[model samples]
Target: MSGSDETSQARALGEALATLRRERGLSQAEAGARIGMTSQGWGLYEAGKRSNLFRPDVQRRLTGALDATPEALVLQMGGEPASPEALPATGLSARGRVFDGAPLQTRRLRLETDELAPWASAGTVLEYVPGRWPRRGQGCVIQIDDGAQRVRLYDRADDAEVVVLGAGGLDRTERIARSRIQSMSAVTARFDDE
Candidate 1:
């Protein structure tokens, strides 16, 4: 394959692997350990920073770690299937979006109200989006205070939709109707954390 094809295939494989790890609720560090790699190294691999996807050993390790047959992962990574049996259905649609930006900016935020119980606690990591605000229930990482604060915002997509922020506990939920929202941004893609 050409260099471009190789790069594309590598990226696709990297994304697939990352998605699988997230769906399994394994952290990058944990997945790395399973594959005999350090957490940091696994992060790079998931980010497609390494260019050795074609290596036999790497392929073997990945298959073993993901509990998938080599042929299944390989075909999903852009290789043609040798036979119908070689391809296993992963059940995920190929139409999902991928996050292609740098690590999202995060900020400390407090719940502005009681409606967002157990979701957004004060001083939690709020992922931010600079200039784009999402519709209700769209699932966005919002950036406030000029990229200083970031948090995941659950969009309701209604004119009066409220935003939920925070991850742990039941006292962190906050609601901000669309009319009350000052500004926002949409989270186009994310690394699924299962």
Candidate 2:
């Protein structure tokens, strides 16, 4: 294949791999750790910067780490080549919708503590879109009326409160009163130290 064609194929394959990893509910760090790889190493594959997608062994290793098969990865890429516009965007998918015909802005914050360890540790940077509502199991930033901010895994929300998982792990759930929230935004991407 020509160089451009190779790049296109690699990009498509990377998108497929990313989709599989997300479906398995794993962060890139977690997914890479499963196969003894660094998050950056795994991210290169997902970013299509790695050129080994054409290798069967590489494909098997990647898919296997997600409890998937190479066949599944191929299927995820679809039966035919992807058009340029159909390729995945370079960063996290846009979550916030335009409001009153205006676009929302993306923001970033660094974690100062490991308050949400395992999912997000200290020194990790998170990208969030202010107007987007976080889905269950996704990360979110909650700014309270007291001017304190928290990063936690979203659980569920009710009319009165928003539920989240604390650093204590999955069984440790906390509910913050909606009245006390100054703002809440969905985290779109996480970048851990290499």
Candidate 3:
């Protein structure tokens, strides 16, 4: 691993932390509160400002605060960690399509409604991961039992219910019963040209 590798790794970790916090529907203040830290302090970690991100103690506290393990976070961070088992057969696409779980690989979708405008315009593209689950505030493409697919940003997901915020950022939301969903995937990348 070179300096660049380390830098990239830190960046990846920061992004993952931010995503996880959102996925769990916890605000920065909430996550920090769990660990006796301030939101600004937590922001530093999520901004990749701390070079000591891999330090054992730091990793432990952060993961513990999020109710996660180090290995799990690393896997969620994308790319291969020290442990390959973390990510498993799961993967992300980058070159339109790939099986190796390339980081930041983009999967594109075209929207038909301004229902997601300003942030997502009609005919613009949304890129996402087909295998990973969506985070709380991250965009997602979902397939309902009726086989109709739509995109929304997930706000909360539980055993019984899933609440999503969509339409230019939460102007409209859908609270659907989990039983009605046939499939769901995370949105990892986005390409909007509007």
Candidate 4:
């Protein structure tokens, strides 16, 4: 394509990406944070300064971070812009099929150490929902592919890593690579020993 045509197309793509992120109620930083990217890096994509946005892998990575699909982005580019009121307040949508009306998958983990003291001390049994993203400061269980499991407070996550606090105490923090994680679940409840 010609330089001017490429520029125009990039601009259109950037505008669509911006809309998708905004519809999700996320700032550039928040959206970028989900992928371990700097706000300026994300801004470059939105400003049409990044040419890699045209790559399929890049499109998937960026849109997935926004809980969106590249096809949705393209359809959105051709459709009318959404009104502010039309956007969901929380920007989170979940759906599931309940076989025999069964509850969602849940599991319990019993703390064995004071690693996460004050928040979830030893002898605490935690109930967590698999596949659910934890809100900031919430408790979560990180299970690695090698059979290692760690219970920690949720901090933040990016495409590459999950950051959690209180590995050994209230002050410790650990970052685990997403590649090593088998699954992550948000702690829904904690039952303390009597």
Error of 1 at 1 (Å): 2.8
Q: Is candidate 1 or candidate 3 better by lDDT?
A: 3
- Each candidate's number of clashing pairs is 31, 0, 6, 0
lDDT of each: 0.51, 0.75, 0.69, 0.76
User: What would the TM-scores of all predictions be?
Assistant: 0.39, 0.47, 0.47, 0.56
Candidate 3 lDDT score relative to the true structure: 0.69
**What does each candidate score in C-alpha RMSD?**
14.4, 13.4, 9.3, 10.1
Runs of candidate 4 with Cα error greater than 4 angstroms are 1-29, 35-59, 66-102
Compared with the true structure, what per-residue lDDT tens digits does model 4 show for residues 48-92? 898887766787788988767766666556743234454334221
**On a 0 to 1 TM-score scale, where does candidate 1 land against the true structure?**
0.39
| Per-residue accuracy of model 2 over 1-194 as CA lDDT, tens digit each | 57997787778889989988876566788778667899999999998888866666787788877767766676666553334354344321211222232465889999888778888888999999774557679998889899988888988664567789974665689889979988877898999977
Model 3: per-residue Cα lDDT over 1-194, one tens digit each: 57886677677777888877775556787778767889999998898788777665677688766656665566666533454333223222111222253565547788888776666777877877664566567778888898888788877654466788774455887887778887677776667765
Better of 2 and 3 by lDDT: 2
TM-score of 2: 0.47
Which runs in model 1 stand beyond 4 Å of their true positions?
75-80, 83-194
Q: Candidate 1, overall lDDT?
A: 0.51
